[model samples]
Target chain A: MTVKELIDSGKFEVVNVGAATDTKITDVFCCDLLSIAMSRGIEGAAWVTVMGNINTLAVLSLTDMSCIVLAEGTNLDQAAKAKAIEQKITVLRTDEPEFKAGLYIHGKLG
Target chain B: MSDTITLKYDVSTDDFTRAGEASSDVKRKLKNMNVNPEAVRKVAIAMYEGEINMVIHANGGVITVTIDPDCITMILADKGPGIPDIAKAMQAGYSTAPDNVRDLGFGAGMGLPNMKKYSDDMKIETELGVGTTVTMKVFLAA
Candidate 1:
């Protein structure tokens, strides 16, 4: 689904829509470990994690992920939020648990 | 892109907020150079891991990236307490980073391994109490 659709679904609140609203998300990857996520992350996927930090945004940018889904109600700190904006990273927020958020995106992808 | 491009960055130990700036800049420059995406990813991940290690363990370091048509070489040199056991440190899930770094979601003992996994070639030269230097290269032809 496109980023706009995910935003419209109300499953996640929009934190930053850096990637165009029409950007397509091909899959979902759930991981909290930054290195593991960087090594294993797939391009065009929506990364689901509770790591709301500047490093997480850096990882997403390096991996070319479509967007970052901050699960479990996690929010980016001030520095991370500023970096996200400056870097133009697409960030989404959800109150659901990490796995649950991944499942939701997975269901939609299928 | 026929001429070699060299970039240098000084990683600061004082802030975790800016840890990945050097790697991020490298990634952007590589992409702009129209380097292979796979190669770019490898260089980015490998260099980023090295950058984080400098911030977490060393008192920061100097990263020099030399990019040519055939390969990208990154040299990360830091003056900090060196790794005592290279063998054990190479193993996955081994980390000496303090608890605070762990809370930052790093220090998982995956840094060196990930750097090795991504780069085409890797080497480490270190001395206890002196420092450590990690050299990694990612070939662009792939």
Candidate 2:
């Protein structure tokens, strides 16, 4: 599904409608550690994690991630949120637990 | 793109906000050069891990990416406390980064391993209290 569809679906909260909202998301990956996510995230995947930082934005660029979903009620600080906007990487958020968020994204992807 | 193209960037310490700028630029340049997407991904991921290491561990460092038709070479050099045991540090879950860095979602002890994992070749030269230098290469297959 495309990121726009995911955002419009309203399963996840909108943190920022980043620059790449039109990009297609082929899969979903869940991880908090930046390095692991970088190593394991699939191309065009929607990254789900509670880690909100600038490095996360960087990782999104390095990988072909379609978007980032901050789970477990986690949120991005101003600087990180600003960078996410600048990078145009779609970022979503959720107060639901991380597992629940991942499940929802997985269901949507299927 | 038969000729060599070299790019240099100074990675600042504790500036996590801008840590991956150099790697991002390299990725963009490689893509523009029409380098293989897989090769670009490898180079981008490897160099990004190295860049984060520089910010988290070293006071700062220099990243030099040299691109040619056949390969991309990355050199990350830093003047921070070097790794005491390369073998041990290379372990998948080993990390010397402090708690704060861990909170930033790094320091999982995966940087060096991830760098080695994505690149075609990697080498490390380090000395305690002096510094560390990591060299990685990703070959572009014709």
Candidate 3:
């Protein structure tokens, strides 16, 4: 599934979406630690986490993850959002916990 | 024909917000160079962990990446209190980072091990209260 579909499903709120929503997502990976996300993160995966730091953006840029879905009411600061835009990472927001978001993504994609 | 390419970056002191900038830049450069995807991923992870270690343990330092036809070598050097026991520090889940660093989504004690796991070769040269230099290489020829 594409990032567009996840957003259009009305389950998430777009925080800072890149110009193209057609990014093909492979799976959903959830991790709060940037290192775990870096080492185990898969390319084209939608990362669901409470991490809302610039390092998260850096991981998103390096892993080339499809999008970042902030869960558990995580706060995304202005600097983080601005960097996400500059880095071209699609950012989304959700009130649900990370596990719920992960389940939704898993079910939706597969 | 392949040529040697090198890039250097300076890591600052305790700037978690901008910690991975250098790694991200190197990853981009590797992609642009059409490096093998696996090699690129390995290099990215190893370098990123090294960079984070610099900020967390050391006061921050410098990273120099040298890419050649056969390998991508990352050299991370920091001038902070060095590791006293390499064996203990290398153990997974062993961390000396404070609680605050863990709260920032790091200090999981997986940094050094993850760097070693991803890279084909790794060496640690350190002196207590002096500094540390971690040299890691990812094979690009394979």
Runs off by more than 4 Å, candidate 2: none
Is 2 or 3 the stronger prediction by lDDT?
3
**B1-142 per-residue lDDT for model 2 (tens digits):** 8899999999997898888899999999988988988998999999999998998889889999999888899999999999999999889999988999998999889998999999999999999999999999999887
Residue-level lDDT of model 3, residues B1-142, one tens digit each, is: 2889999999999998788889988988989988998988999889999999999989999999998988999999999999999999999989999998988888888999999999999999999999999999998774
Tens digits of per-residue lDDT for model 1, A1-110: 98788888987898987756688889999999898988989988999999898889888888888899999899898899998888778899999999999999989986
Interface RMSD of each: 0.8, 0.6, 1.0
Mind giving the per-residue lDDT tens digits that candidate 2 earns over A1-110?
A: 78999999988878889766778889888898889988887889888889888888888878888888998888888999888777767889989877888788788876
Quote the positional error of residue B77 for candidate 1 in Å. Answer: 0.6
Candidate 1 pairs with clashing backbones: none
State each candidate's chain A TM-score: 0.94, 0.94, 0.94
Worst 10 residues of 3 chain B by lDDT: B133-142
Error in Å for residue B2 of model 2:
1.0
Order of quality (lDDT):
1, 3, 2
Give the clashing pairs for model 2: A19-A88
Least accurate stretch of 10 residues (summed lDDT) in model 2 chain A?
A81-90
DockQ of each: 0.81, 0.93, 0.80
